[model samples]
Target: MPDECQPLHNINVGVLGHVDSGKTSLVAALSTKLSTAALDKHPQSKERGITLDLGFSSFTVPMPARLIAALPCRELQFTLVDCPGHASLIRTIIGGAQIIDMMLLVIDVTKGIQAQTAECLVVGEIATQHMVVVINKVDLLPAELRHKLVVKACKRLAQTFAATTFAGCPMVAVSAKPGGGDGPAPPAEGVPELIGELVKMVPAQPRLVRGPFLFSADHCFLVKGQGTVLTGTVLSGSAEVGGMVELPELRVVKKVKSMQVFRQPVSACRQGDRAGICVTQLDASTLERTLLCTPGSVPTFTSAIAAVEKVRFFSGTLPSKGRVHVSLGHCTLMAEVTYFGTPDGSGHEPAAALRLVLDRIGQLALNENVGEFDYSTDYAYQHELHGLEGRPSASGRQCQHYGPQWALLKFSQPVTAPKDALVIGSRFDTDVSKAACRLAFYGRLVALLRAEDPSELAHLRIFKLKMRAGSIDRVAPDGFSAVCKGMFKKDTDISLFAGMKVTTASGAVGTIEGSFGKSGKFKVAFPKGIVPAAPGHNSITLTFKRYIYDQNKRNMVQ
Candidate 1:
């Protein structure tokens, strides 16, 4: 918690770039002057020419805080995170990025916008994070090279950013080396000015109506006098001293005895602020890269996942179609890529949209773009998902016609039923059946949507269900989840109940037959016209049943 005068107006900024793009140096130059780190004077940082790990620092800006009681002063606080420029660390960088306000993208002036820059652009696209492109090392590039690089970098950024949320990011050029500022200074001038612009761009803290305080851990250490010190950018809400923090990834909850920012002790913090929480009861080893939130506010982990309609990857080689790691929030899990289905391959080049089955963790929010991966030693193999603002790309032209229509997905592991999930498809021109096979391998059911017959959904042998307009909630492309709602019309055979599980497209098996009220209202049974698939225009009704799986068993949600 910040003091009254400073009430915690924290804006988190993340630095991204190509190797040798001066990501660490910029951080070093900035933090050495304003932050508490000892200026990161490492020989390797100079010799190797890349930032090996994430760096942290802080600076103060003149801004107003939303809440006066939570601040130490009226000024806004900015936390800077310097991420590695190489591709291998992109995952780790992403873990640190969940709370960032703006990405400071650095490009080598000599090299201009290279493959890594494109990869970073893609990652930022998926995250929907804002950005500012910096053409670094201007001093090393000749005037002609510098102008050409900046233009090229801007063009590449514009194209990729256009596909996502960062279509209009600010662009500039600077050299962090001694006397690198050229005859005239960069528009923002010193790092402080750049910091100010970032503060301006970051939105105010998010409202956590009833959520656990979420802190994304980037650094953890054991303090001499304090206990475990975990530092991370706060994604949302606020936390006071003694707030119980549940570490979902580590499965531990400890009381926060104290807090700090930029190494200085503090009382409280709000969304977007970088914080160091000291938990007296926990050891440093117990804390990993995780999201620490207030116990009750944390959302439950489910096997079902909901995603937007499409998924695209940048690796031209196409993924091998197997299980891979997914890190979102603080949870890292293995998700199987069932296959590359549906070639909505419109925009961009060779990379196509793909379908993935997250083995566990269901119930993704509507239209949320998540990241994917394919690891390689060269630090060049990179991937990212894109969306057209709030929607999937317009199944654009220039896409190879992989005739398999209807975006569908099947999970290698049947998601715990009732978990919200989405079936994503790729944009490449691969055989739809082959893509379905890949999805099956990853553990998910695949289905094809006939553009001609929007009413019928083709399931790959397992189940072919028809789409009834009001029966199910369409979570994403080729995705549907059971919902409980009152029936608009009455039917003798069909009964609708609230909270009953409707299994199969038929509303049969694994369903709640009836729902009861405290007042003992009308009792209902199965409706006459209940079928595996419902009409495109009819509503999905579930009749309440007294069928309890077990008296002592917890419901599927728990």
Candidate 2:
């Protein structure tokens, strides 16, 4: 127990692991208190013998010396968010991971890291920097070999996470249910040791409690005649009794009647603190989950632009125009991604319609610390994913690659989220039986498209390069001109491509001045006289680009 007068600071810890890896049992062993939706309370979860939803529970410990020196709290609350490990429920895991301060990656000691463990590892790396890998169910091993095998499992896990952000993180062996599985288990082993390790690492990962009030309400229900209660973590800022909250989904405004932390009444809640907010007159059934914040703090968006980075574990390519399941806030909605890149070279000038859209993207380039899509600069359509070194040129049509990239996520339905919310794109359509990592990329929303102007970028432009090669048939009687064949069909309209630039394979630069004859052959003019090539001998190449979505049906060449 802690001093009633002393303040309590919170650290939301997520317990993530594979199915039947003892995650719920581990959480049950560690938790001193449970919230409304804690444990496997769902009827379906009990019937299936697995966790089917995001469960919330917590325990409190005396504040450590390091934290005492930094804050004014006397007790530290470790809120346990139990995330399901089933492959089909990965969307819930991804959505739940957004609110956690740190992650506890649980691994079954006997089986080691399984496929689901690997996927959870990817989410942990992308979710937060702090992680403590828990090796559970050591009690299942024979006593004679338990010590040896446990040590071996720890070493194996440490090696597997060596290159990840959690490298050198603490690894503890624990038996949540010493009697095994469920039913009236004996006292848990090594949990106290696990708690000590968590306390040590938390001081380095501080919470931000300042800013405008923003609460991520994950579970909402009516509390008899009192009112409706919204339970979740405070994403940012603080709100107190009587403070007004806007429910964007319901389009209603309500005043906070009271607040509580793990059933203890509190005057207010701040960022990083998990609390239940009670408000009057709002129907619980109206919203299953939503954001409760200062009026209009978040908006509904039909689409958005994000500065994206590829997740390394995702084995597949993130091609432009690919369909992905996008996780925005707590909503996992289907989306179509349009990826583009900014290379280092002379930027292509966009048409008038495109210039306006880029101007809008420029306004959204916020924070300044991280690069967003540059609307002032032109970008090219990326056929495949690019790394820090960029990508190779195609068809030798000349290209300059840059490291930074952006993605345009167009959702099938409208969504509500604060600006700069974390964006995770996944390919849930992938065959789960293959055990492949379906997470394609992750980024932050930089530009938001309002519902009314969904077609604001209908004419957006990204260019795909094109190249054509033809043979220098012969030098006309004049040495300054040469007839080039193979650039077009015999019946082609030769006048349409007049004056486009072409380069010879021998390093000579020239231009198509006009048509050579009715056979669709063309004459290349080299202002500086060129060495005459034997009939049908030398090679020449033509390079150009065409906008992918230009409504004018325009093409460009240089």
Candidate 1 residue-pair clash tally: 68
TM-score of each: 0.57, 0.87
In candidate 2, position 362 carries an lDDT of 17
Task: Tell me the lDDT of model 1 at 43.
Answer: 57
- The CA lDDT at 261 in model 1 is 72
| Model 1 / residue 200 / CA error / Å | 4.6
State the lDDT of candidate 2 residue by residue for 312-354, as single tens digits: 6677887777788999768889888888765432333333122
Tell me model 1's lDDT, rounded to 2 decimals: 0.48
Whole-model lDDT for model 2 versus the true structure?
0.78
In model 2, the Cα lDDT at residue 381 comes to 80
In candidate 2 the C-alpha lDDT for residue 376 amounts to 50
For all candidates in order, the CA lDDT equals 0.48, 0.78
